[model samples]
Target: MSAFGTLLWLEFRKQGTFAMGMLMVVAGWSLLLRQFFAWGAEPSIVALAVVASTLMLAGAVVTAYLLWLGLDFAREYRNGRWALLLGAPQPGWLHLSARLLFACGVLTLFAAGMWGTLAFWLGRVGLEWPLGLGLALWAYGLGGVALVVPVLFIGLLVAAYLPARADLLAFLVGLLGLGQLLEWSLRLFSAQFYRWLPPWGLPLPRLGEMAWEGFPGLPSEAFVLLVLLCVLLFSAMSRLWQEVEV
Candidate 1:
């Protein structure tokens, strides 16, 4: 396999088991919730439970996974594996991208799973689950979660270069600044001119022949800015990786 491919395989092997375990936990909880809903429990209540449980359980699991990945960059002492990888010919972007891509793939599966699980129970009650809108909303929420990978990674890179006792403080500062970067980027890009850009225009799931109006689909402008931000963050991360002392 090529170098990037090797990194991805290793990452998959290292983290795949955890991913599968978390998936099972999510699926198992979903099944239990489904049973509860089947017991003539209120659909509204059951749906709320599904949302809460999935967010608390699966969300934490994924957060922990990404935090672990990001924290690796901040370690003061090199493990044998880190030692070997740093010695390899790969660029820092390759390593970071491998992890980012894997996490994104896992996150997408998770978003889909959450939507599916919710839809499964919702369908039993003759409710219309808006597939397009539901998935888009999930993407928006979970995409925020995914954005944290670069933030944490970037924060830790700054921390690694700071005095030992000040590392946490530095990371906190970086976290605040990097977060504003996202917020301001959104503010800057969400201008009226941006509205002129093409929108995703995905169809809303019909509610039993009820017509809906004025539903703005996903904004292509925001999507463009997000992609640009990701590229900028990734480039910063790769540069900091080179400059950061192990």
Candidate 2:
């Protein structure tokens, strides 16, 4: 295998079990929610839409995965594994890239599983899949990924910069709290004010709502801008990793 491939495979081996455990938690919650919707009183379309939006815009689920992967990288750094990897032939960017790619793959799978559960619930409740929910779910999942890129990147930064595991945990908590504050602030501000701000004002709930409202294709402009931001963040992270004192 190539260096990048080897690094990616090692990352998967280290984090795959934890990733699976997180997936199982999501699956269990999904099943319970499905049963509640199934056995509980009949739900209106609005209620269903609200629930669907909430499921797609689940920040907690995304944050949990981010923290898991972030701590894994931090653990490597603290345990001297990161220094050993740096001794290898490949550049530091390749190492960071491998972790980022692995994170993207894991998050895509997480979105898929969450969407599949939502679809299953919709099907059991006598809703058609393709015509009723499939396209919207696809759009939401893609948008969700776009929403997650920066977040995961931020997590990586925290892990790489902070020395202690407890510090990493505290940073993540503060980060999540700050994100929630920004989200709320965006909502509270005027639409005109939001338009004046950067794309960060456009939160996941808005993206999910657009999907639910049948906006076609990917949110192309937002996705492209986010991809660019991820690239910038990745470059910065690579530089930081190289400069860190062991």
**Maximum-lDDT candidate:** 1
Residue pairs of candidate 2 with colliding backbone atoms: none
Candidate 2 Cα lDDT to native: 0.59
Model 2 C-alpha lDDT per residue in residues 143-179, reported as the tens digit of each score: 5544444554565456555665455675677579657
Local accuracy by lDDT, each model: 0.68, 0.59
Q: lDDT, candidate 1, residue 172?
A: 72
Cα lDDT for residue 231, candidate 2: 67
Query: Per-prediction TM-score, please?
Result: 0.72, 0.59
**TM-score result, candidate 1:** 0.72
The TM-score measured for candidate 2 stands at 0.59
lDDT of 1 by residue, 1-246 (tens): 898899899779877986787678668877787566766776555655665776677567767766765565445234545545545678878887897787777777877777787677667655567788667766665566456656646554654656466776777777788789878877777754476777698665443454358877677676677678777777887776665553
